[model samples]
Target: MQTRALRTGGFDLLVSGLLAACLLTLCGCTSDRAIAKKEKATHVVPVKTVAVETTQVQRSTLQPATVHAFYRAEIRAKASGFVKNLQADIGDYVEAGAKLAEIDVPEMLMQRQVIDKRIERLIAEEQRGQAGVRLAEARVRSAQALLAEASSQMAGAEASLAASQAEFDRTEDLVERGSLQNRMLDESRMKRDSEAARRDAMASSIESAKAEVAVAEAQVVAAQAASDAAQAETEIERSQRQEMDALLDYATLRAPFAGVVTQRNLEPGDLVRQSNEVGRGQPLFVISQVDRVRVRIAVPEAEAALVNPGDEVTLTFPSFSAAQPIVAAVTRTSGSLDPSTRTMLVEVELDNQDGKLLPGMFGQASIHLDSKVAAQTLPSRAIRFDEEGNGYVYVVGEDETIARADITTGLDDGNSIEVLSGIEPGQRVVGPHLKRFSDGQKVAVLPN
Candidate 1:
């Protein structure tokens, strides 16, 4: 009976041990399967992508500018004097040759009066000299008449002397023959001698008359010289008077063109002087041609090559809030870069017929450059840098796994970069997963 009971207990213990071993094996297999599934799901990386498109890109440059007049002028006082009246004020429109201001020149007027008086005196002197010349001519004629009378008297006296001499000769012959008395012959001879003396006196008188005529001729010459001198003096005085009159006219200022008086420096009764300082040419009043305006800008040396004359440009002025942008064309350039600022000067012209724009206004300009070839551009954030300082991106492979790609870059326009190589259009790239990426990493793509 004791042997049979011990065998039954040993059999039951063996059965319990076998069942526990089988259960342990089954639980180990199930845990290994669960771990494999978790590892496969967690190791795969999901990435975002962008589509590449071919489009035209414009190269542009922006710069600050200033508005100016096409032609500006500064009006100054040409003649010095006291301002008498002001005809135009600031912001007044004036035509060419219009009166601007008038000056009081009392000294000039007095000078003209003096010149006139001198001319009158010279004329009076000339007339007096002419009268003297006429008087001298009359005296010469009177002297000539007296000389003719003296000549006639001398001829008569000579005839009488000849007759008396003939008689004396005959009387002397008779006395020799005792036909006449000696007293009679002496009387005849006395008569002849007296007539001869009378003829000599008349001849002397004629000579004196000729001398008087010569004196009269000299007087006429002197009078003519005086008249010529007086005429010359009158001409000189007349010329002086004309010059003073011209100076008086210069005292009145006039506008040189049709434009608005943008500035006023002096008023009535103000004293203005001419400017002679270097670089400060003049400072009386400012004038500008408001029919057209100009804008000047300085472009940097790196971008100056892209601008050209006649190109369209836009200008904006801060002074006008509701004013539309002024459209203009590039008129000219400075042609050389400035060494100090490394910029080139540019000018644009615009119409301002309404006088809305003024000189010295601040503005800005935008210049369009040449168009570039169609290229694939990516966002700047898509690019990545490695430890070796090489730029690259993560490209999605056919099996949807991540692979590191090396790329060459071109121009960067602040928002996007031109991809030169190492990537094709339509290829999926990792979107900024720079910190959590590795070579040949498994990835899951995100929907667009």
Candidate 2:
């Protein structure tokens, strides 16, 4: 029993020893944790910083562009006819007024011939009527001369009749007084009767001449009317001929301006309908002036306001990558946006004297919109973003304390970012690992 009691006492002592060791170990671990906390409070984090600088910053956008001719035209037929001769073909260069094709219009030719014949006949008829008018005028003059002659004869006959009557009266008075013979009185009476008959005949002749003059004048007016009608008919035929000539001119298709033929739709002998006709065929030719080329771009509304005439543009053709890009200035821009597309139309003109640029070619255009000569900027690594997408930077103060500052960014070129606000030139900001630093934390700036 004594032995069992001693073993129990020894087991109690072992337990007590273990308890002391455990308590001491716990105290040491607690002391080490306090020391670590103190060291952390006094520690200074080392960081790399960059100075904010004022430099030139440029903003640009790239958009798809298409090359177009300075002037383009689709030449269509104005007169329906079968193609007879093709003077121009695809890729042919032509000057202004150069004939491109000729059309064979048999019906038009027949109509023109008929008009010519009709005009000739009308002209002849007009001349015949004019001759008749001249003849009528001559007859009028003859009739007037006859009337004048008759009037003179009538006056002479009347004078004679008056003298004869006086003689007869004197003779009769002498006979009654036994101074003259009855035969003498009878002779005077006979002479007076003959003069009166001559005067009456002359008066009748004057009336007949006046009636002839009236008839001649009426004939002259009628002849003149017929001549005027014939002349009017001739003029109407002439006007029809002029209209036919105009229509015939359309059979010869000529170039409206100097250009290269880009397309040819009809061959010789092909029937082409007039452009104004229903169910018209394709155009005869498409001409494009390529001495100068236009690069057209549709700029989105977001950047449309930044685009303007005289701005520089760089054109790169994907199809011709090895070819050097063309540099030109913006020629113009549509001030308003397209309602359907919501994009602004912009154009750039390039001199293509070498004939390298062609219509329908596509490329990309890089346009410089805005530039700042002296803008505050920070390295891209120095900028950080919050959960709301707002950008901030860790600014290192003179006392080496870090401060969080919100900044407005303007343009970024991958390496550097333009700081429009909340920063100044010569200010230092943390370069990278921005999350490692906090507001009011002390830091040691590393040497550049």
Candidate 3:
């Protein structure tokens, strides 16, 4: 009976051992299946994605700038003299062409008086010369009349001499033919000789008249020359007076344009020198037009080409911080870069009718460098850089597989990056946790 009992107990024990071993194997299989399931789930990463779409992209730059007056000028003395009647000082508004001050040019004034006297005396001389010319012309007419009378007298003398000769010839012929008395013939010859003497005396008188006419003509010429000389002298004196008048006009300083005086360096009774002289002296005044202002900016070379006239700009002045930023369009550009600083000059004009904006003020300028109207873009996080600095994105295909796509990018606005190439609209790209995915890896899209 003892042997039978031992055999049953051993079988029970073996059965218990077999059950424990089966339970252990079952637990081990369950643990292995759980781990495998977790590994499988990890391979199919759940990623957030975004669709590539078109949007507006902009890029801008900020640069320091300065404010200046629209028009400024330095007023200086044009004539050397003592300052007198100084009518303008600093902070005075003046009109264009208004007299600002008068220069006390005592010597110049005295010289002007002398010039006036000289001009008056020359006028009298010119009148005297005119009278002399009239006298000379009258003498010429008298000389001409005398010449005519002398010619008439000469003709009459010739005719009478001819008549006397004819009578003598007739008497001598009659005497030779013994038809007349000798005494009559002799008397006729004597009469002819007397007529010849009279003719000679008349000729001498005519020559004397011609000589008088010539002398009168010579005197007339001399008088006319003297008259012309007097007239020339008068004209020269008048020209000198005119030059003096112009110099006198320069003695008074006038405003070149309508503006406010921003500086004053001279006072009444101060000696002023000509501004154009060697070693130019200090300016007497500074004029500026404050109804309008200009903001000047120096854009760097790299972005100079992007700036253009008429582009919108925003300006902020440090002195007027509480004031709103001023919006204006670019007024002008230098078109070329400065060689020394590699910068381009740009300016914007604004109306300052209120006189709030002052010259030499500091400010900031925000300039739009580039803009895109319908650019393909994605979230900035969706783009990544390679070791070579090239940008890329993980694009999800229709099969839900991620394919690394290399891309070219343009303007970035912090939130979105413009895709210049390699990606099209409607394409889905991985947005975040990009490091977990690789090329050709499967992924599950999560709602974003």
Candidate 4:
């Protein structure tokens, strides 16, 4: 009986120990389950919702620029004088040949009047010279008449002498033959000698008349030369008068072109001089043609190749919010690149027929490049660079969680950036952040 009892006690002890072990194992399992439930409830995962939609992505460049008038002119006074009247003021629209200002050029007008008087006097003098020439011609005619009369008298005297010499020769022969008396021979000789003397006297008179004719001819030639000289002087004086008259007319300033007067420098009664420093040509008015305007933009050299003539661009002026964006065409470009800024100069032309655009206005230019392969565009803030300069984004996963993704990027057009690869359309991207946000972090998006 004692042996049986000992065996039973041992069995009881073993059973009790087995029951305790089973209870401990169940309690341990319960504790483990509770801990796991608490941990699962506390862990928060990052999430961002995404929707798929089509969006246009444009790769463009922004350039600062200014508006300029295509045609500009500085109106100046061409003649030196005191300003008499100013017809136009700044901001006045004027047509071509419109009078802008008038100068009081009394001195010039008086000079012209004097020149005119001189011209008239020269004309009278020329007429007098012509009369003198006529008088000299009449004297030449008189001298010719006298020379002809003297020639006729000389011929008569020569004939009479020849007759007398013949008679003398006959009388001398008769006397030698004793049929003629000495007195007859002497009378014949004396008559011949007197006729000869008269002939010689007539020849001398003809020579004197010829000399007088030569003197009269010389006088005529001299008078004609004087008349020609006087005529030339008259022409020169007339030309001078005309030139002075033109100068007087130029005293009135007129618009050089059809444009708006941008500036006015002088007022009425202001004295103007020829030297610009002395306020001569001091831009009595400034005119500019605003029908067409120019915008000069400096584009970075890296992208300058894409900018060329004929390219369309959009511009915005800061002053007016309601103003519509102006569309302009690239008219030309500065072929050389600026070394300081590494930029090229580009000029764009825009129509401004309404005169709404003004020169020297600041603006911005947007130039679109050729279309590239469809790329994913994200808000510029979505991209973050690590310490090594590698860009990445936080992408939402299927379980409403976040995953960090690496992406390659291209041009950033202010608001958005082009995702060349590693991103897709409709992907959720973070907006600009005030502080750095980690990947996989949960975020609540504000209502748009």
- Using TM-score, give the best candidate's number: 2
Which residue runs of candidate 3 sit more than 4 Å off their true CA positions?
Answer: 1-53, 57-65, 172-176, 182-221, 277-279, 299-316, 319-337, 347-349, 364-372, 377-448
Error of 4 at 115 (Å): 1.9
- Measured against the true structure, the TM-scores of the candidates, in listed sequence, are 0.52, 0.68, 0.67, 0.63
**Weakest ten-residue segment in model 3 by summed lDDT:** 274-283
> Considering TM-score, which of the candidate structures 1 and 3 is the better prediction for this target?
3
TM-score of 1: 0.52
Could you arrange the candidates by TM-score from highest to lowest? 2, 3, 4, 1
lDDT of each: 0.80, 0.89, 0.84, 0.81
**lDDT, residue 29, model 2:** 99
Off by over 4 Å in 2: 1-51, 56-64, 154-208, 277-281, 299-336, 364-374, 377-406, 410-418, 428-448
- Cα lDDT of model 3 by residue, 304-371, tens digit: 99899988788999888999999898999999999999999999999999888888999999887666
Alpha-carbon RMSD, each predicted model: 13.7, 7.8, 12.4, 12.1
Quick one: ranking by lDDT, best first? Answer: 2, 3, 4, 1
Q: Which numbered prediction scores highest in lDDT against the true structure? A: 2
How would you encode candidate 4's per-residue C-alpha lDDT over 193-306 as one tens digit per residue?
Answer: 999999999999999999989989998998888889889999999888878877776887888788889989898889986544544445667898888888899999889988
Point out where model 1 deviates above 4 Å: 1-52, 115-246, 277-282, 320-324, 371-448
Deviating ranges (above 4 Å) for candidate 4: 1-59, 78-81, 133-221, 277-282, 334-345, 369-381, 384-435, 439-448
